[model samples]
Target chain A: MTEVVAREIIYCDICSFPPEYCEFGGTFKRCKDWLQANHLQLFEKLYSDDALAKATSTLSIEKEQQISRDLEKKQAKEEAKMERELQKKLASKIIIKRIERNRRKHVISISGLEVCNIDMKKLAKTFASKFATGASVTKNAEKKEEILVQGDVSDEAKEYIENLLQEKGLDEVKVEQIDDKKKKPKPTAP
Target chain B: MFKKFTKEDIHSRSNIKSSVQRGLKSKFLEQFPKLEPAIDNVIPKKSQVILIKCEDKISLYYVENEVVLFQHFDDLVPSLRTVHKYPDCFPKVQVDRGAIKFVMSGANVMCPGLTSAGAKLPEESLPKDSVVTIYAEGKENALAIGKLTMSTDDIKSINKGIGIELLHYLGDGLWKLVE
Candidate 1:
């Protein structure tokens, strides 16, 4: 019978392989099969075989800390990107400036009732031209009025309307500057 | 323990219903000693009464005869911020500094009356009912009746009539209803 003998083993540095088989760390670390074949390379490089038995135990805690920090940085970057996009979208909605001195003037109420009292058809026509939306008067005797305007109203348009009312000597003209988001436009069917 | 009271067992059932009824009556009396007579008169004879207990609050309402419960649930007034604008629709409410007070048949109701009514719904909008809760206004108790309107916002800004529809006269003390 031949004598049988067992020798000590060595493992790869990066991917955890036996050192005798792995001359360089790069090949084993980059190769998918290399790590699986030489599972103890990285573990052996960091620790002895006795320590390798507890390989996953201490390693996970350090890895978990690293992963949490990386995820936090990624989330912060995404939130900043989203905020920038929202600002851009909101900026595009508004078209604001001082009122033009010579823009043609027309007297129309924000509620659209004052126009109805003067002329229903004429009021509708004027509203269609300027607002390009619609108006409604309550059927009941209370006859509350509401107006819908197309696009976004600029500060200039608002000022013009206020000036027209002031010139007409109306009292306490309270004009609310509606946020573009709150101002809902009518849906076009086609 | 939960007990089943089918139609047949209604009369033969335990005195749970009567016990609840008595408990509610006693609680109501303790809260509003003054409104005992008004409550006794207003509550229908066959009205179903229940006492609901919540965190630091208790409430009693006569369900069967009170149609106002349906209106209160419909108005969504419990979501309202204020009731100042609809003086005609709502009972004549008194404003003190920032708080609002209203009286109905010698009961007090309170509201902050902060919001305006109108443009509340998206389209084909109609006014909704309100759920006003009465609290003490200075020395007076508020009878929190539901307001019949879409929003207090419209009632305030429009200078209109009938902002809130009076639904119920909830007493000031002991009884605070929670949906």
Candidate 2:
């Protein structure tokens, strides 16, 4: 007697494989169409192109281009405003002030030389040797980097800075002095 | 055995010029002729090399994202750990589970640990003093890198004594420095 062995073939609704090897299946186009027809609710829950497009219409290419152009115009306007503000700051003036550190002790601080493009380290070193005082480059409360020299050397510093700027070919560099209100003399008895 | 390294010690080493670095690369390739094709890919022309002086002097060659290669001692041997970064770049030898602790502790690899049951070694012949990565039994990552003390035939025949001299192992100074 001869025995017959039955073989069963299974086709994947997802791909060419028997569903166990779905990852190996390259494309899901046929499976997508089958699901769209056979399982409408499941397909709609899984993927809805029309609904996604409706939800993110503003992010579409045409809308995005329009928004990007508007953003570019706004950025250009802001950049021009910033440039004007910087020019105004450069034109204003340089202020050299003397602040009282303690009784009979004061420190000289120079600010607004940021537009000059001079090296701060070199400038500080020059001021230290020229004025015979310890000088350092530091940032002020306003977040502006400036030079601070020990002892009150505002008058000497102002003249030196003006001469240095002129030597560097910056003709319009202006130096201004600010009086220390905290160090003012007390009123005498009447 | 490994030596401790400070940040300053690593930084003080001079940066090798591109021309000199090329010479070093050629020397390394001469030692391991099998790595000719993959050498360029590991240490590209744009990569930088720094000569670090240590007990076994090391040359650290690296780029921003990847540590390309490091040369040790007068031999200028290429780093097995770095080459192992690229899968199958070098032949691997699997040690028995009993040897995993010893390997991690930076001990010389024993021949029995490699020829024992459940251990594996490449079928191809590997020359003496060749660099090969050591992996623990059933593990995917290489646990240590060593220089083969003797040829593959010697290991197969004798199946005893030290097979490879452990150069860099897990938790060693070189591993920490690379990290």
TM-score of chain B of each: 0.30, 0.82
True contacts kept of each: 0.00, 0.00
Query: Per-residue lDDT tens digits of candidate 2, residues A24-96?
Result: 2232345557667766775675456774344334234675455445545644665577669767755867889
Q: In candidate 1 chain B, what residue range of length 10 has the lowest lDDT sum?
A: B1-10
Candidate 1, residues A1-190: lDDT per residue as tens digits? 2222212233333433233222212232233355446565653443466643442232246653564455456446655776686565333321122222233422223453352124334544565566555433223234643333333444545665566556655434445554323233578788
Q: Write the per-residue lDDT of candidate 1 for residues B47-68, one digit (tens) a residue.
A: 6643222222212233442211
TM match of model 1 to true structure: 0.19
The models' CA-based lDDT, in order, is 0.35, 0.66
Identify the runs in model 2 with alpha carbons over 4 angstroms from their true place: A1-190, B3-11, B65-67
